[model samples]
Structures are given as structure tokens and as C-alpha cells.
Target: MATVVLPRSLVALFPGAEHRVEVGEVGSVSGAIDALEARWPGLRDRLVEAGPSIREYINVFVDGEPAALTTPVPPRATVHVLPAVAGG
Candidate 1:
């Protein structure tokens, strides 16, 4: 399992989850969403989308770099997902 840190907003989505993980390279963000959907079928409809652009309000990182929206993530890694809120 990967150790994931999520912003407060997203934390609500993963109720009772202490950490987060996807199926690894065989999967991607889509996979994570898939897995979550499998468990809570209503989840995918809320968390994922497909269009000309992904939502700009989010910033998902893996090992501190921006994560691939479609790239596969490995298990046993660290990931962070947060809203793109910033200010001077």
C-alpha cells in the first residue's frame, strides 16, 4: 500500500481510510478511481472525469512531483493529492 496524504477536502472522500493505495503499474489514477468505485460504486461518479481538460483545481503529487493523471502508480510509495490553492 502507498502512504498518501490528501488535502482536507479529499480526506472526506476516503472515509475510514488511514492510507491510500492503487493496484500499482497495472493501474493509474483511473485505476485508483476504479478500485474505489468498486468498493463504493457512487464514488467514481464524483471523483473522476473525462473531457478536454481535467479539473484545474486539483494537484496530485507522487514523491513530490506532479503526478500523471493517467500514469500508473506503484504500490508502497508516497502520494499526495490536494487542491491547487496558493497565495502570496
Candidate 2:
């Protein structure tokens, strides 16, 4: 999980409504989605895209650094995905 630590601002987005996450494997985002979906069925549709590419305003991080949207999943990495905040 590369010691995943959630940013304080984005706590409520997680389905768990508890701890954020620590996705250790990048390729396993789908796997994680599946797992989370099992727990909270609504989560899969809310999080993952039905086809390809994650939804907009969402960013993933690896190793405490920004992971490009085009970057393929890395092995044994850390991923933190959160929605972009905006107010106008």
C-alpha cells in the first residue's frame, strides 16, 4: 500500500465512510472496485467507468506522487483516488 495516508479533506468520498484506502497495486484498481462493490454495491458504478478510462475530476497517486491518468498500473504501488473539489 506504500503507506497510504488519506488527505484530510476527502474523507467522505469513500464508501466505507471510515478509512480512505491504500491500494497497493495499480492494476488492481478494478479488483479493489470489485471488492468495494461487494461491500457497497453502489460503489462500482460510482467509482469505475463501465468501459474504459476512469471518470473525470478523479486523480490517482502512486508512491505519494501524482500518477498520470495515462500511466499504466504499476506493481506493488500506492494509489489514492479522489474527486476534484470546486465551488463557484
lDDT of 2 by residue, 1-88 (tens): 4323344444455545435554445364555555455655565565556465566666656556665544444566655767767789
Residue 61 of model 2, lDDT score: 64
Clashes of each: 0, 0
| Candidate 1 TM-score to native | 0.62
- Please name the candidate that would achieve the greatest TM-score relative to the true structure: 1
What is the C-alpha RMSD, rounded to one decimal, of candidate 1? 3.2
Residues forming the 10-long window of minimal summed lDDT in candidate 2: 1-10
Clashing pairs in 2: none
- By summed lDDT, the worst window of 10 consecutive residues in model 1 runs over 17-26
All candidates: TM-score: 0.62, 0.53
